[model samples]
Every structure is written in C-alpha cells, then in structure tokens.
Target chain A: SAVISQKPSRDICQRGTSLTIQCQVDSQVTMMFWYRQQPGQSLTLIATANQGSEATYESGFVIDKFPISRPNLTFSTLTVSNMSPEDSSIYLCSFSGDGKQDTQYFGPGTRLTVL
Target chain B: AQTVTQSQPEMSVQEAETVTLSCTYDTSESDYYLFWYKQPPSRQMILVIRQEAYKQQNATENRFSVNFQKAAKSFSLKISDSQLGDAAMYFCAYRSRRGSNYKLTFGKGTLLTVNP
Candidate 1:
C-alpha cells in the first residue's frame, strides 16, 4: 500500500474562483487518477494524469474545467477552473504501485465547497 | 466500460452478528479485480478486502470476508462479529486489469449502521 497525502483537505471558495488540490505519494506510482464525488452521488473518474503528458479526461469531464498537472511520478495537482456552486464536491486522488495489479490506493480526499 | 451496483442503500446490523453487503458488476472482460472500501465519518477511504478474478478461493481479512460468485458476477462482503467500528459507508469497486488506466468503477455505496 502507498501513502497518499492531499493538500487543502477542504476549502471554501467563491463561485468564480478556482482551487488547486495537490496529491503527493510516498512511493513512485505509474498511473495517477482523479475522482469526483458530488453530493449524494457515487465517485466518478475525472481524469488520468500521466507524467510528462496531457491528462486524459473522462467522457463527461474536460481539461478546460479541470486542468491537471503531473510534473513527476510521485506528485500531481488538479485545478478546478471557473468553479460554480454545482462544482462543490469531494475530490480524491488515487494511484497504483504495481501497474498490472490494478489495486489502487486513495488519498484522504479534499472536500471543496463552492459558495 | 465496467460498472458496479450495490442494491442496498442502507442496512443495520446488531453487534456480534453477521452482515452481508451485496455487490454486482457488469463487465465483458474476464480478467478484473474487485474491491470493498469503507468510509467512516472521517470520510477517508479504507480498503477492506479484495478479490482477484483468476483466484477461485475467496479473499478473507480477519473478520472481513468476501463471497465472490464469478459466474453470477456478484461479489458480496461479509462481516462476522460485527462491531461498532464497522458502521460506515461501504463501496464496491471494479477495475480492469489489462490497461494502464487504473480507473476504478464504484457503486453508489451502502451505509451500514451497527447497533450496539
């Protein structure tokens, strides 16, 4: 199991502002993913942050609204751009130490409240 | 694409009793992984147990065990001697083992309330 730490465990922001959440892993991982859990909803995959490349987003999400940056194997960040009240949700980061196994370890999660 | 479904939204179990949470999945791929995660009031996701598709024997971790019925595409978690600490929201997840995607498809989750 890998230890994942996410910064800004929670934050309250204005509707038009943006918040950047950071995810740091204790060990180097091959694949890093971002997920969003809206109120009373299940966790949804936001994007896959690959090191040294553009993030691959899911069908319902886009890079413009959620920009991701992965400078290296152990660190990544997800930025919610031009936030709104509907964007209020818990953002979680996860990664797998062994690529083929597909067992992912998740962070504590960042609870974002957009006012 | 894979999807997971947890039928029960809420369930209550008496302490020292046994409880089972149902989970069903849809996937065309034969090789995959199934996981059970627990989220308490602190809102941290904790891995409870895992099941590999290729393994015939079910996975068990202490008081937590899984009944994996591959033919039925069902994976349920069984908690024996249920304790107060076992009360939490449990999520069932499925992952495809073939890709580098590492994306987990999760169910809506079942909130387990343990009565002491």
Candidate 2:
C-alpha cells in the first residue's frame, strides 16, 4: 500500500473563496483519482487526474468548478473554485498501482467547511 | 453502468461475536472486482478485503472475509471476533475488470457498532 497524505486536513473558507488541497504519495503510481463525500452520504468520483493531459471530470463536476493538477506520478492537487456552502464535504484522493486493479488505497481525506 | 448496493444501513454486534454486512451489485460484466472498505469514526477509509470475479475461492484476510456470489451478484463482508475497533462504516465497491481506466462505484455503506 502507498502512504498518502493530504494537506489542510480540515479547513474553513468563505463561500466565495477557493481552496486547493494537495495530495502526495510516497511512491509513484499509475492512477490517481479524486472523490467527494457529503456528510452522511456515499462518496462520488470528482475526477481522474492524468499526468500531462487534462484531468477527466465526472458528469456532475466541471473543470471550472474543480480544477486538478497532476504534474507528476507521485503528486496531485485539487482546487475547489468559487466555493459554496454546498461544497462542504470531505475530499479524498486515491490511487492504484500498475496492474493492480483490485487494490486502490485512499488518503486520510480533507474536511472542508464553507460558511 | 455498474452500481454497488449495501442494503443494510446499520448493524450491531457484541464484542467477540461476528457480523456480516450485506452488499449486492448490478453489473452485466462477468469479470470485475469487489471490495470491502472500512471507515472508522475518524473517517479514514481502508480496504478490508477484495474478491476477483474470475476466482472461485472466496478471499479472506485474517479476521475479515468476503462471500462473493458471482451468479447472485452478491458480496458480503463477514467480520469475525468483532472488536471495538471494528465499529465503523463499511462500504462495498466495484470496478470493471477489463478497462485500464477503472473507476470505482461505491455503495452507500453500512455502519457497524460493536457493543462492549
């Protein structure tokens, strides 16, 4: 399993401001993904951060709202833009190694609160 | 599209006893992967066990085990010797077996409480 860490473990921001969460992995990985979990709700995929190319956003999410950066295999960042109270949730970053479809590890998750 | 379902919203067990969290999924593909992830009160999710559809034998990890029924499309997690640490939210997840870009579809989750 890869050791993953997310900066700004918990944060409170103004409704109109933006906050960027950083995800760092101890080792290089092939696949990295972002997920959002609303309070008391199941997790939903936000996007897939691809190295070099643009991040693949999920249906309900758009690049304008949630921008991602994957400059390398071991690092990625997700920024919540134009934040709203609705964006208050836990954001998680996960990754899977090469040829390891059955194993994906999750980060500790960043808790965001917009007021 | 694949969908994972965890029917039990909540469950309870006595310390040293056993508990099973029910999970079912909707998928037409034969080859895939099923996983059980545990999230404690602290909300750090971790993989408990995983089962490959192509494998007939069920997967087990120490006290955690999975009953994967391919035909029935059922995957349940059985935790033996339940401990206080086992009290957490358990989520069932599914991923496609064929694709390189495999995104996980997760169930709502089942919260388990261990009574001392």
Candidate 3:
C-alpha cells in the first residue's frame, strides 16, 4: 500500500486560466495514473504516466489540454491548460507498485471549478 | 473492449444490516481482475476488495467480501454490519491480465445510503 498526496486540495479558477496539480508518493511506484470525475459521475481515465517516458493518454484527451509530467518514480504533475467550464471536475492521481493490478491506490483528489 | 455495469444507482440499508452491491462486466479476455472501490464525501477513491478471475474462493476482508462468478461475469460486494461510515459511492472496476492494460474500466457507481 502506498500513500499519495496531491497539491492544491481545492481551487476556483476563472475560465482561460491554467492550473498545475502535483502528485507525490510516499514510495517509488512504477505506474502513475490520472483520472477525471465530473460531479455525480464515474471516473474517467485521463492518462498513464511512467517515469522517463511520454504519458499515454486515452481517447478524447490530448496532451495540449492536459499535459502530464512524471519527473521521477515518486513525483508527477498534471497541468490543466486553458480551462473551461467543461474542465471543472475532480482530478485524481493513483499509483501502483510493480505495475500490479490490485496493489494500486488513489490519492485525495484535487477539486477544480472553472468559473 | 471491456465494459462495467452497475444497475443499481442507489440503495438504502439500515445500519448493522447487510447490503450487497451488484456489478457485471463484459470482457473477452479470460485472465483479468475485478475490484470494488468506495468513495465517500471526501471523494477519495478507496479500494474495498478485489478478486482475480482465476480464483474461485471469494475474497473477504473484515466486513467486506466479494462474490465473483467468472462464467457469469458478475462481481458483487457484500458489506456486513453496515455502519453509517459505510455510506458512500461504490464503484466496480475491471482490468485485463495484460500488463499494458493499466487503466481500469469503471461502472456507473452505486450510491449506498446507510440509514440509522
């Protein structure tokens, strides 16, 4: 089990502004994942970040809009660029040791509201 | 492609009683993993229980257990001695055995309201 934390617990930003959320882990993990969850909706995978490699984004998400950086095995950042009302959601970061399926855990989400 | 479904949107149960949350998934892969997550008002996704496709013995933790049927593609979470703290949004997830499938396919989620 890994303990993860995200910076900027909550933020209210005006449209067109960008916010970068950082995720730090207690231990070095092999895989870091980012997810977005709209109010009262299920989670949607944004991208998979691995150290020293470009993040693999899922369909309907682009690097220009949601750029992710995994500088090392224990840290990563996700930047929400040119935010809009549609981007108002809870951003979550998760990590797993050895890239296993069950040892994975999630960090407390960063709630963002684009006004 | 894989899909997870949680037919029940919301369920109410009395405290100290048992409650079951249903989950069904569609996948072509034979080897996979199923998980149940709980998200309370805090919005932190917590892993409640998980089951491997190859393992038939149900996985149990304290008061949380799962009934996984591989041929039926069903994984349900049963919470016993439910407490008010157990009230939360429950999600069902599926993952393939392949290492490349890092992302999980999640269900619509079930809101469990534990009434006093």
Candidate 4:
C-alpha cells in the first residue's frame, strides 16, 4: 500500500467560492482516482486521473465543475468550482499501483463545508 | 454496472464480542473483487479485507474475516473480539476485473458501534 496524504485536511468556504484539494502519494502509481462522499452518502467516483493525459470524468461529473490535474504519477489535484451548499462533502483520492491494480489505497480525505 | 449494498444502516456489538455485517452486490461479471473499507470519524478510508471472486476459500486478516458467497452475490464481514477502535462506518465496495472498468462502487455504509 502507498502512503497518501491530502492538503488542508479540511476547509470551510462560502457559496460561489472554489477550493483545490491536493493528493500526494509516496510512490508512483499508474492510476489515481478522485471520489466524493456527500453527507451520509456513499462514495462517488468523480474522475480517473492518469499522468500525461486528460482526466476521464464519470457520469454526472464534468470538467467545468470538478477540474482534475494529474501532473505526475504521484500527485493529483481536484478543484471544486462554483461551490454551493450542495457541494459540501468529503473528497478523497486513491491510487492503484501496477501489480496491485485491483486494490486502491486512500488518503485521509479533504472535508469541505460550504456556508 | 455493479452495485454494492450494505443492508444494515447501523449495528451494535459489545466489546470483546463478535459481530457480522451484511453486504450483497449485483454484477453480471463473474470475475470481480469485493472489499470492506472502514471509515472512522477521522474520515480516512481503511481497507479491512478483500476477496477475489475466483477464489473459493475465504479471506482472513487476523480477527477480521469475510464470508464470500459468489453464487449468492453476498459478501459479509465478521469481526471477532471487537474493540472500541472497531467502531466505524463500514462500506462494501465492488470492482470489476474487466478491462477499463477500474472504478469502485461503494455501499451506503453500515455504522458499527462497539458498546463498552
């Protein structure tokens, strides 16, 4: 398993604001994923971030709303744009290595609260 | 598409006792993977156990074990000698082994409470 960390741990933002959550992994991984867990809800895949290529968003997620950046194998960022109360949720990042593609290790998660 | 379901919204167990959490999934593919992830109040997703669909034997990790019934599409986690640290939100996840379908589908989660 890889050691993963997220920046800011948590944050509170006002409506219409934007916040960027950074996910850093200890080792290089092939695929990085971003997931959103809304209040009392299950985890939802936001997108899949692959190094050197544009991210692939899941259904109901768009580039304009949740922009992702995979600058390298071990780093990725997910920015929540035009935030509202409905956007408040815990955002998490996970990664799967070459030999361990079936399993994914997760970060601590960034807890966002919109006011 | 795959869907994971955690039927129990909440479960309680006395400390040092055993408890079982139920999970069932719907998937057309035969080869797939199921996982039990624990999220404490800290909100970090921790992998508790994993079971590969092809394997017949169940997976065991110390006191944590899974009962995987491939035909029944049922996967359940049994915790022995439960402790305070064991109380958390348990989520059942399913992933397809097919190519290009690497996303995980998670259940709504079962909040486990360890009563002292």
Candidate 5:
C-alpha cells in the first residue's frame, strides 16, 4: 500500500475564501480519487484525477467549483472555490494499488471548516 | 446506480467480546467487490476486509471477518475479540469489477464503540 499524505490536516476558513488541499502518495499511481465526507455523512466521489489529463467530476461536482490538478503520478491538488459554509467537509484522496489488488487506500484527510 | 446501506448507526461491544456491523447493497452487476473500511478519530480510512462477489468464501482478516450473502445482498462484518482500538466508524463500500469503473460507493457508516 502506498503511504498517502495530505497538507494542512485541518483549517478554518471564512466564507467566499478558497482553499487548496494537496495529496501526495509515496509511490506513483495511475488513478487518484478525491472524495468529500460531510459531517456525520458518508463519502461522496468528487472527481477522478489522472496525470496529464483533465479530471472527471461527478454529477454534482463541477470543474469551476472544485478544480483538480494532477501534475504528476504521485501528486494532486483539489481547490474549493468561492467556498461557503456548506462546503465544510473532510476531503480525502485515495488510489488503487496498480489497479490490480482491488483495493483503494486513503490519505489522512483534510478537515475544512467554513465560517 | 449502486447504493450501499448500513442499517445500524452505532454499535457497542465489550472488550474481548464480539460485534457485528450490517451492510446491504443494491446492484445489478454480477461481478463486483465489497469492502469494509474503518475511519478512526484521525479520519484515516483503513481497509478492514474485502470480499469478491465471484467468490463464495467469506473474507476474513485477523479478528475481523465478513459474512457475505450474495443472494441476499448482505455483507456483514463480525469483529471477534473486539478491542478498544477497534472502535471507529465502519463504512461499507461497493465497487464494480468491470472496466475503468474503479470508484467506490460507500454507506453512511456505523460508529462502533468498544468498551473495556
């Protein structure tokens, strides 16, 4: 399993402000996924980030609001734009192991609190 | 659309005792994967066990095991000899085995409390 790390474990931001979270995996991976977990709720797939290509966002997610960047195989960034209180959630990044083992490991997660 | 359901919102067990977390999912696909992930206070999702839909045998890891009934669409996790460390939010996830669809559908989660 690749060791995953996310920057700014948590943050408190004001409404209308934007925050970018960084996810870095110890090893190179082909596919990286971003998920958002609202307080006391389950995880929802925000988008899929693949290196050298634009991300694929879910139905409710948009590139303009939740932009993703996959500069390399091991690193990706997710930025929440024009954030509101409803955007407060824990964001996680995960990747499957070479897409063979049928498993996905996740990062520690970035907890964002919008006021 | 695949949907995973965790009926119990919370569960408790005494140390060294046993506990079971229930999960059910609806999917038309025959070949898929089911997983149990634990998210502790630190919010790190840890894979506890996994069951391939094609396999009849249940999946187990240490004291954590799953009773998978494909016909009933039920995948329940049984934790024997439960420890305080086992306390966390358990989420049931479903993934398709077919083509580039590797995204997971997760349940709301059940918060487990292990009391010593």
Candidate 6:
C-alpha cells in the first residue's frame, strides 16, 4: 500500500475561478489517475496522468476542462479549469504499485465547492 | 469496457451482527481484480479487502472477508461483528490486470449503517 497526500483538503471558490489540486505520493509510482465524485454520487474516472506526457481523458470528460500535469512518478496535479456550479465535487488521486498489482490506493480527496 | 454493480443501495446491521454487501461485475477478460473500499463520514477512502481472479481462495482481513465467486462473476463483502465504526459507504471496484491502463471501474456504492 502507498500513502497519498492531497493538498488544500477543502476550498471554496467563485464560479468563474479555477482551482488546482495537488497529489503527492510517499513513494514513486508508475501510473496515476484522477477521479471525480459529485455530491451523493459514485466516483467517475477523469483522466490518467502519465509522466512527461499528456493526460488521457475518459469519455464525457475533456482535457480543456480538466488539465492534468505529471512531471514525475510520485507527483501529479489536476486543475479544474473554467469552473462552474456543476464542477463542485470531490477530486481524488489514485495510484497502483505496478502492472502486477491491480488494486489502487486513493488519496484523502480534495473537496471543492464552487459558488 | 469493464463495469461493476452493487445492487444494494442501503443496508443496516445491528452492532455485533454480520452483514453482506453484494457486488457483480462484467468483464470479458479472464484476468482481473476486485476490491472493496469504505468511505466514512470523514470522506477518506479505506481499502477493506481485495481478491485476485487467478486465486481460488477467498481473501480475508480480520473481521472483513470476501466471497469471491469467479464463475458467477460475483464478489460480496462480509463484515462480521459489525460496530458503529463500520458505518460507511462501501464501493465495489474492478480493475483489468492485462491492460496498460490502470483505471478502476467503481460501482454506485452501498451505504451501510450500524446501529447499537
């Protein structure tokens, strides 16, 4: 199991403003992922952040709205761009040990409230 | 695409009693993994149990255990000697072992309440 820490545990922002959430892992990992959990809803995959490359966005999500950055294996960030009321949700960062392991360890999650 | 389903939206169990949460997944691939995660009021996600598809034996961690039925594509979590601390939202997840993509498909989740 890996220890994942996310910054700015909770934040409140204006509707038009954007917020970037950071995720840091205690140890280096190969793959990192981002997910969104709306109020009273299940989690949905947002994208896969690859080190030194563009993030892979899932269906129904666009890179323009959710830009991701992964400069190294142990760290990644997800920026919620052009936020709206609908963008209010809990953002989580997850990672796996390697290809051999299938379970993911999740961060504490960043709670964003868009007003 | 792989998908996980948790039919029970809500469940209640008395303290010290046992409870079972049902989960089923759909995947064409033979090799995969299933997981159960718990999210309490604090909102922190905690891994409860995990099962490997290739392994025939069920996985158990103290009071938490899994009933992995590979042939039936069913994986249920059994919480024995439930306590107030066990009250939380439980999510069933699936991951494809063969793909380079390290994404997990999560179920809708089941809210578990334990009453003393």
Candidate 2 lDDT (Cα, whole model)?
0.93
Write the residue-wise lDDT of candidate 5 on B1-116 in tens digits: 99999999999999999999999999999999999999999999999999999999999899999999999999999999999999999999999999988899999999999999
Worst 10-residue stretch by lDDT in candidate 6 chain A?
A: A96-105
Give the per-residue lDDT digits (tens) of candidate 2, residues B9-104.
999999999999999999999899999999997788898998999999999999999888899999999999999999999999998888675688
lDDT of 5 at B42: 93
Alpha-carbon lDDT, every model: 0.92, 0.93, 0.93, 0.95, 0.95, 0.92
lDDT (Cα, 0-100) at A39 in candidate 6: 97
**What's the interface RMS deviation of candidate 2?**
0.8
Tens-digit per-residue lDDT, B12-98, candidate 3: 999999999999999989998899999999999999988889898999999999989898999999999999999999999988878
Model 3 ranges with Cα > 4 A deviation: A98-101
DockQ of each: 0.80, 0.84, 0.87, 0.95, 0.92, 0.82
Clashing residue pairs found in predicted model 2: none
Where in model 4 is the C-alpha error above 4 Å? none
For residues A83-113, write the lDDT of model 2, one tens digit per residue. 9999999999998884574578999999999
In model 4, state the lDDT of residue A101. 85
TM-score of each: 0.96, 0.98, 0.98, 0.98, 0.98, 0.96
lDDT of 4 by residue, B70-104 (tens): 99999999999999999999999999999988899
- Candidate 1 Cα deviation (angstroms), residue A56: 0.9
What residue pairs are clashing in model 1?
Answer: none
Tens digits of lDDT, candidate 4, A19-108: 999999988999999999999998999999999999999999999999999999989999999999999999999999846888988999
Per-prediction TM-score, chain B alone: 0.99, 0.97, 0.98, 0.99, 0.99, 0.98
Clashes in predicted model 1: 0
lDDT of 2 at A42: 92
- Report the poorest 10 consecutive residues by lDDT, candidate 2 chain A: A95-104
Q: Over 4 Å off in model 1, which ranges?
A: A98-100
Tens-digit lDDT track for model 1 on A18-62? 999999998789889999999877889999988999999999999
